[model samples]
Each structure stands twice: as C-alpha cells, then as structure tokens.
Target: IDGEQINLSIWDTAGQEEYDRLRTLSYPGTDVFMFCFSVVKPDSFDNLRDKWLPEIRQHCPEAILMLVGCKNDLRFTLFNKFQNQERKFVTSDEGEYMAAVLGAHGYFEVPSFHHSKVAPIFHEGAREALRRRR
Candidate 1:
C-alpha cells in the first residue's frame, strides 16, 4: 500500500423523481460514486440504467463510478420468481455495459458475502479513491 492519507466525503443521493432536477449538481468533486441498484427490480437492467445513469454522467463526468448490484443474498429468493441465471446475467451485463459507456472505474455485485456484510464494497471503493488521489 502507498503511504498516503485519503479523505472521502460520500454524499448519498436518493433515487427519486423529486430529486431529479438536482442530479446534475449532486456530483462534482466526488472522487468515486456508487451507482447502486437492487437485484429485485422487475425492470430490465438496461431500462433502469437508461433511465438513471445518463444524468449521473452529465453531472459527475470525472468521478470514478462503480455500478453496484445490491441484495446478493436475495438471489435464491428470486430464483423462483424469474429464470434463474438468464435474467441475472442480462442485468449484470447491462450494468457492465453502462459502466463502460459512462467511464466508470469498475462494477461490483455485493450482497452480504461475509456474515451478511458489505465491507468489501467499502474497502474496494476506498482503494479506488486512494489510488486515484495518490
């Protein structure tokens, strides 16, 4: 690890229609932004992404974005509701594609992998930030 101090200020913005107008201003100095989405949404990943991330890019053009799929623990729960691997794969692929389009640093699929925890996501995101700052 490099000897460097990293200060991260995370401004969590809610995904809401009411906040739509502020999206452009919400991102400016953000070093890394997490674009998190639930695995449970019935909409296609592309559809959701098309509706959401363009605004983010418009605002936070230089931020290192990470497209995250939340609720990994619920995968099995959704297995019965949808085609097991097919839909999941499509959504994930769409996220990856969107990430590429938006100049994101990476894509993360996190769902309580360790004792129902999400530390890895934080750690990795921090690493990205620190690495960039250095």
Candidate 2:
C-alpha cells in the first residue's frame, strides 16, 4: 500500500445456506478471509466458531483470517428498542476473545456504511498479503 497499487477483490456471499456448495468454490485463491457476524445477533457470532471457521479452514487451512462484527451501529439501537425483552448481543470482549481463540490476524467491530472504518480491515489484509508475498 505504500506507493503500490493493490487490487483487492472481496466476495461476500453472506453465508446463505442455499449456496453453501457453490460459495466455497471461490475459496481456493483467497488471500484473506474475513469471517463476519452481526454484533446484534449472538447466533451469528456463535456460527463463526461452529460454522465459518471450520468451513474456511477446511478449504484454506493456513488462511490469513480476520473476525469482523458487522452492524455495530445497530447494537445499541436494537437493544434500546427491545429493552423490555431479553436479548443477547455479542460484546467486543467476546469478539476479541474468539479471535484470539481462533488465531485470527485481527478483529473489528464496525458500523454499517462507514468506509473510513471498513477500509482499515482491507488495508491490514492487503499489508498482510504483501508481507507474506515477500
């Protein structure tokens, strides 16, 4: 990234079970794998260790992995809206702990529609890929 032009391609299949078979076909040449889950959805975070991490590792065992908690902006909003009801949101501490347990390269909690926030995830990915290239 330091004076070098890097073309980073991102594929977000959104983990639709209907395309599970087809989705993994694109995993072969992936340099970085960002296993993302919604911060507002504890189930999605649980799926990371139960589903995603295993699937990606099966295909790309030594992949440079990052755990991303998406829709962070909604965490508080959803909690307030559903304040009377019981709900569980994935905490930043849990995300960080999971990343450490998974041996991920990094972990991020990001708001939707913020390019300033999103860019660093890819930037780190690009830098890691570049370093590995050398």
My TM-score estimates for the predictions, one after another, are 0.70, 0.91
Candidate 1 C-alpha lDDT tens digits along 28-109: 6777778777666646355445765677667766667777877666766677677645654335666677778867777767
All candidates' lDDT scores? 0.67, 0.90
Candidate 2, pairs of clashing residues: none
- Displacement of the residue 80 alpha carbon in candidate 2, Å: 2.7
Best candidate according to lDDT: 2
Checking candidate 1 for backbone clashes, the offending pairs are none
Q: Candidate 1 — worst ten consecutive residues by lDDT sum?
A: 40-49
In terms of TM-score, which candidate is strongest? 2
How far off is residue 32 in model 1, in Å? Answer: 0.8
lDDT tens string, model 2, 1-134?
97789888889875878999999899998889988889988898999899898999899997899999999999889989999999899989999999999999988989977868988888888899889888
Once fitted onto the true fold, the runs of candidate 1 whose alpha carbons sit more than 4 angstroms away are 1-3, 42-44, 81-98, 112-117
